[model samples]
Target: MRVTRRRPEWRVTAIARDTYALEQKSPYAQCVDYLLVGRDRAAVIDTGLASRGALRSVVTALTDRPVDVWLTHGHADHIGHAGEFGAAYLHEADRPVQAAHSDPAFLKRLLREEMGAALAAVARPVVRRVTAIPPADYRWFGDDQVFDLGGREVTVVPVPGHTPGSVCYLDQATGGLFTGDSCCDWGVLLHLEFCLPPAVYLESARRLLGLQRAGAFRFNWPGHHGFPAAADLPEQYAACAESIADGSGVVRPRRHHAVVRYRDVLITLPRTYLAQPVGRR
Candidate 1:
């Protein structure tokens, strides 16, 4: 897999296809969006970021399928550009944020001051202005929500703690989970804002562990860079959460794009557990 970092967005390419993300440089990385392609129709997992036009271009280049967008949460960066799409979907709890995307100026101010200035300069000469996708375009996700994307399917799993309505999209056909910042390589560790207490995040992490143990997924595509495969990450996350819950886990601060090494820390409860079964506890 190749990760391409554009001016304010990141594009991940796999299997000769691509997924887009927006991460303007800031103390806190705002939001990360993804565009999942299919033969007939395309699904964009998140849309609020600096890459609204880029996201649209990538989707169009991949396929002419009617695009469907869903947000992991309703943060400004995750829902801002959603208005450009014909239809956008997000959790019911995030509808207000999505509705706010209709107002371009409001959305612009929400961006980091520097990013807003850059964005303004780009939009001045652009022929089209940002528009809003109608409310009818939204889809509310309940538990076990299923989206049929022709041959492949995306299951909406409520991954709270990060946000009241935050979710992860699991593509059964690919064994990949589109984790929207539920986990990431970024250095910012502000759990208080995006999620509940550390315990809530831990439970969410444990839930992902159960799915990994069940062989539900193999690849983990997080909203941010440096994601791990299910076979490599699930057990580790579980172990970390277990340790944290018991006051035995030590979270070593790592760099923004540091390469994670298993030996640096214990590989107790992640998807790696499935990879090396002979050493199982």
Candidate 2:
């Protein structure tokens, strides 16, 4: 039963000076993609999901300057239209598995994990309709690497826990950190097969905490729900990961996995738990 309906528009906003955000509210969760307009050219950060359709036309309406695409990580939701914009920069560490994350079976399992049994019956069919992950011209970079977008610069700070090549972009001009699946106040899953252990994740959290403490950035601009999340999410998440790493956090069973909570944040652990082999840092 295909329910035909209107396609949702990208909720556009000027998140910062010369920086625009196009947000897609997916059936299961919300996703955001950003466009940063620099003096010479513009860069699109992450591409949301393919369901949102091609973004180049939308971006062209925003700026006439040449454009570049950058992926914060390789998650299906984040890199959906990456190939639509030509070659994009992603950390080499994520190159191995990033391309295969968008297949229908993977999305089905992921939606099941996120939406749970309640919606699985109605959602699986929708997931199955998704086309294969598009092939991309990928240019990989490493941590602390800076991309000069003419006048402005964005540095990639690798956070491996979410995915081995997961990173947060520190926008030099506005002091905003474009953190993708990482450092979200909603829920952070460290249980994926490609994710690093809690101990490794904690290190990334600590780095964010330190960057926050030093005023490296003003807000944590996540790829999901809620823009500029609570000021102390990094701190709380650090403690949560720490508790899990040390086995002191109270863990509760949740469907296929368990979760450890710190305040309003929940860090889901893999069923294999801490026994999963560590990935490259």
Candidate 3:
């Protein structure tokens, strides 16, 4: 069978009234950023990895209101174009990762490791563009910070597991919860050096579940390819993590490491980390 790939480009889709999903596809990664316009100012979530300042043009065409950049986490793919915008805001816990990624050397090292030599060679220009525009300054914010954009309010919910500072933005006006890589349809990655253990991640998932039960938000917009995840995704993710925490899930090898799969969610971790007694919820 022949394989086909989606051409990488910058496209915008209106997800809701006054809200748009700016999707950027590349050979390296597919990133879905968001733009929320309010009565006064507008907010951009998770600027996609676009070199040449294409994202700025997209946002400008969407709304002329003052814009603020808010990061879901410090991942390179998410914050690559953040420098084009003014000061960006992120959780303090992720500052280290964000700072490290801002360095050209560190990003190059990461590309070499994650993409390997052949792929990295092809992805070098994209990587350079990603790191070219480093944010002038990153404003640190904590959990539960409410950003009021005139009539719309977005509450920051800390969902630390994908990354120490990973968070979901709950839009009070639209009932949309923007979850970066914290939870997704493809799979939630928990194997990186900066990622938390499955047990700890379960807590964050449970918290989201609590919000879901309380009618806090209606839908989820994941960071990557999948958008508007099913409402029960948090519950399902929590259950998967629970099994992993208790050593009940079957382990399978993937890319030289073991992972526990639960439905659409995959929990990847080092064997030693999985054997640790901590974070057994």
Candidate 4:
């Protein structure tokens, strides 16, 4: 679908006491970026495929505190407006994708290949609008790194499945976990070149499950669709992974890729990974 200029602009919804979700309704992808406000500074998670000025304007209207942008992964939709923010951070594993996506030529190829040529033609303008800001210099952060936003602290947990550097941020004060596409209620996309195997993703799912069991996080906030995923989402994703490992899931073809359905989650991956030994990363 073509992105029209008449579509709704960036909108912000308060998700928690100090957390807000910025929903950008783009024809290419309806993405939700987040802002966690704190006493001293604020943290922004994921910059959607919106115009850099629009994202910056919405963020500035939300908080006056100093803001830091933390990317969930290196996807084009997630990092389009990243250059608008200062103190941006991303994982080293995603640097290659991030760097590649910053180029307009690479982005054009991605849109044509993944989203289809027809959609790519319509989305070219939107892509240009979002990419107006040059790629920002990103500092790297690893797993278990804690970002102290005054009284609130968000811990970064590495969950590399959707992409090599996919991560979830756990809010220590609110018991809310921001899972960026690693596990979403809608579905998980593991068919990309940078995506990890289902077995490797299963391990990460188990890690999130362990955190839930230990009361580290009470709720999950995914990067897309709605907020506060079902409590059993982690379990459901884990079961899906298990089914993929056991060769019990029914596979179906979509576009040019194959997807395996298990429980409420749909996993898209290469058939080669499914044929490999289970639990192999």
Q: Rank by TM-score, highest first.
A: 4, 3, 2, 1
CA lDDT of 169 in candidate 3? 96
* Better candidate number, 1 or 3, judged by TM-score: 3
**Residue 4 in model 3: shift from native, Å?**
20
Q: What C-alpha lDDT do the candidate models reach, one value each?
A: 0.55, 0.80, 0.82, 0.81
Instruction: Put down candidate 1 lDDT per residue, 1-281, tens digits, no spaces.
Output: 99987563444444324344334333233445566666667777776444334556655765677888877776655654565566666777655544554456655554433245546654432212344332335667666688876776788877665566777888877777877756544321223223344455567777887887798877776665554533545455545545545555434332211122332233222222223323222
Cα lDDT of model 2 by residue, 1-281, tens digit: 99998765577799889999889776644788899999998889988876645677788889988888889898877877777776788998897557557566766777777668888884554454346445667898988689888899988888888899999999979999999988886778887768777888899999999999999999788888888778899999999988887677877777778788998898988766644333311
Of candidates 3 and 1, the better by lDDT:
3
Candidate 4 structure quality by residue, lDDT tens digits, 60-79: 98899988898999887788
The local lDDT score (0 to 100) that residue 260 gets in candidate 1 is: 21
**Model 2 root-mean-square deviation:** 4.0
Model 2: per-residue Cα lDDT at residue 19: 94
Tell me the spans in candidate 1 whose CA falls farther than 4 Å from its real position: 1-12, 16-32, 51-54, 95-137, 186-190, 227-231, 249-281
Q: What is every candidate's alpha-carbon RMSD to the true fold?
A: 9.9, 4.0, 3.9, 3.4
Clashing pairs in 2: none
lDDT of candidate 3 at residue 222, scale 0 to 100: 88
Candidate 3 clashing pairs? none
TM-score of 4: 0.91
